[model samples]
Target: MHFQFDDRLNSFRQEVRDFVAANLPAHIVNRQRHKSFAPDDLHTAEWQAILHKNGWSVPGWPLEYGGTGWSPLQQFVFNDECAAADAPVFPWGPRDMVGPIIYTFGSDYLKETFLPMIREGRHYWCQGFSEPGSGSDLASLRTTAVRQGDSYIVNGQKIWTSGAAVAKWGFFLVKTDTSGKPQQGISFLIIDMSTPGISVRPIQQMDGDDHLCEVFLDNVAVPVEHLVGEEGKGWTYAKDLLDHERTGSSYIFWNKRELAKAREIASSETIDGIAVIDSEPFRSRLARIEAQLTALEWSVLRMLADEQTPWHPSALASCLKVRGAQLQQSITDLQMQAMGRKSLRFIAPQQMADFPVSTLWPDYLVGKTSVALITRAATIYGGTLQIQRTIIAKMAFGV
Candidate 1:
């Protein structure tokens, strides 16, 4: 029932800030300051390694699994400090998302092999849950894995898989039985990206990044040991993984930092003759966003504080995801407003990749347009806004 950070949590937050200031490369911080959609693979690797060395890589996990054993509030503090310090986005799938599912449900062999790799950031892992026809309707996924002795032959196509083009491993949901209900026949399996029958074609996003991909699995053989939990139980596991994903989708950290950036941009620029920050309309918008952000911050804290509140965790997550996705776009739109015509100075992904921050416009302007455009997809990716609304209706209200 404590509403404020204890001294221990306060000290931990300061340590995180100090460590980030001391260890994160200057260039990495600069890209982050400019609101880069995602840090390049190189920076992600190096920063994760530094965090691992300091025993702070996976703050939300249990200590036995190489986590910091920090309380939920401390984890929040760490996330907040990292965002404020402009640190690279943490690797979620490998460290938090699938990692938990693996430890809690995976075999000892799966744990022994993957946990160390994840903890050390050795290989990147991507989610393979959303097939072309089965995004929010995940149980309709057509990917099939037919068991044959020691391995299963997997065949299907998965679209919108982030980092699939470069990831080494994937956690997937494949149909193991079609006789049962739609949600009853699925199985969770981990497939190697290097498997011979696997092919990954990058999908060029409107924001100009080729990270999202279409993965075709043609008779790809996966070891049976890679299956998580048991056959005909993947629906449960996928639900668990997604529940964790939706909680983080609230995006408290991103919202907080972007709101600050909007304020910064407003204060620095002028509208007509006065500063944008000084204009009444601009001030009003900022106030509204800040108010919403504050309410969201409290909602997240409340859910994190006690999972057994009146609302089910999934229902709470849906509520947060809906509001959070909306706020993400709104903040970005306001940022676009703050940049004014400067937002129109579009920079190609290749240009940003080839040149240093200085070679382009000022640091603040480097990736503003790109992030703003990509934010338009925020509501679509993580169980779209409309879908989240439906979930809230079903879970929070009996209908």
Candidate 2:
């Protein structure tokens, strides 16, 4: 767990930086800078295609499955550098979440059908886990899937489904048998978004974007083959998928990049004729956040290096998620503070083109307000702050 830099790692980092600088389209980067959640579908696909061509699309997966066969440290460096370079955040549902579940537990037919599309950026995917009342208590999901010979007829609703509007497919959690325990009866099923009985309705957000959506399925027939692994074992696969990218729950790369942006804003922004960074109050706040960020990064690196911890792996992941969600809010808060009055000038996504660009309203300040607004839900989504703390208490301390 030593924090020393290795020459090999440093060189690898430089290599990734060079690749992104040479290959990443400037227009996409510009659009990404203004986006608070994720890049638009076109830019995301274009960027993913470029990465796939260079064999860097899925760096953490196994070599045979179109991965780079990179060690955990190498994967960490790759993500860190990419975030710093403002690479479009590729859809994680396809590459990180469902892709792994399919490859690891899915049948050969499933792998042949989905993995190539995911790696090549030919399809976009979304998770259908959280429903109206089941956001945090995922085990209580009531979506039902009844077997009908070769297919399962699914009928339910999923809320807060990110990117569902643009997604071509979705992996959902459904109750296959209510006779057993809620957790025991749950099953995982992949459904085509274009299915006859499926509908996606975008939910308007305070940020003026419809990145989140409500998905409804009425008698949506999903192929039996689409069920991942075995029946009534979906709860297990879902947990594995959640824990697959454990360190990602920390959001270290994103926090680091946003922190750097916060510093840039502070250096340029003025508070009563003094640069924000020069103010004692602002400097102290920035320093404290930097220290916390450093500690968080070290903790993630220790986990990547397989350093043992007293807590269970699930509890550790929950701990990281709690801290990372806080930092997301804090870093954005600092940016909003740095912008001061400028942050108050709200610009909807549709008005960006019409919005005038001037010294008073620079590109950097364009999405700061919107991003800050959306980040308020960081602690609520994935898992609520209260739920994560309860998890840590139950699993880590056995309270």
Candidate 3:
């Protein structure tokens, strides 16, 4: 398989880099560079608007749907350059996860109503799949949507919903029927977050951020027209979304950027007057991580190129998720090690602007500790490492 970028791709990469350099805001870049958490809703919307103005907002969608019509390779290059430039990670629920499903399977009315808002950044979306007891076992979700003529009354709770507090809309999986199997009774529904009886409460994290939320729906009424595809077909739609999400779980771009930061820290931070990176053991660990990252990147590229693979798509995605989650934790652990005691300083997100800066503790150290603390969940979320291993085993061995 060809690993090198051709002349056209190289040119495209430079073009993206130049655009980001010219137009990406300095303040946003600063926050993204030092902060491990995603940008707030305002910044996310603003960045999406900027990309929309440049006609680069949704590069992976069909050309007719405000997409750039770029090839998969081009999309990869765009994402890599944006991540390298410290671009705010756009909210995936709208742009990546649910948007494609809407365009691909939704009614023409649904498309007309939501697609434009999504592209223009006029609305933000959150996924409402995980319930109180149903996360990895998504088909067992207990949320119910009872049809009531023109609308459906949705009643249940969704936990670990990212950005629900600020999201304008949510795509939820609810049981429209229960007589059939757990997976067969589900239906996909789009609900307005501001709808009465819908309450969102943020769940505080060790990192001191409340990006994750619990959404409680108490007899929330959602228009019947908001349903995506057909009833009893939500499981099918959800699988499509989950596949996209699992592929992204590899977190290649984030890994590359954080690994570079780890290297920078190792170079500057000292151990008995010698740079941490200069030590043999630490250097070896860093080299190993870099090599693993290279392999991960190649695996993602192979998937993008649609190369033949012996493993099923599900198994392949599980393998990538397992390794990618491992690398995230390892890289962050190395960063914490390099920072040593300075990593102990805990600065809350709200205090970042007013906190006094020290020459001994530079701005680069702002989010190091927090990131390391939160990355502990890397393997747990997006399906646990154990679960991924089971999937791989089942697919590979039929056991």
Q: Indicate which candidate wins on lDDT.
A: 2
Writing each residue's lDDT as its tens digit, candidate 3 over 293-377 gives 9999999998888888788888888989999999989999999889888888888877775556677877777888888888888
* TM-score versus the correct structure, for each prediction: 0.95, 0.98, 0.97
Off-target runs (Cα >4 Å) in candidate 1 are: 353-360
Candidate 1 lDDT tens digits, 32-125: 5554475366677777888889998877777888888777777888889887888887757888788999988999999999988888787888
Evaluation by lDDT, superior candidate among 1 and 2: 2
**Model 1, global lDDT:** 0.84
Choose 2 or 3, whichever is better by lDDT: 2
Error of 1 at 41 (Å): 2.2
- Supply the global lDDT for candidate 2: 0.89
- Arrange candidates by TM-score, highest first: which order? 2, 3, 1
Q: Which residues of candidate 2, in runs, are more than 4 Å off?
A: none
lDDT (Cα atoms) of all candidates against the true structure: 0.84, 0.89, 0.88
Ranked by lDDT, the better of candidates 1 and 3 is: 3
Per-model root-mean-square deviation over C-alphas = 1.9, 1.2, 1.3
What range of 10 consecutive residues in model 3 has the weakest lDDT sum?
31-40
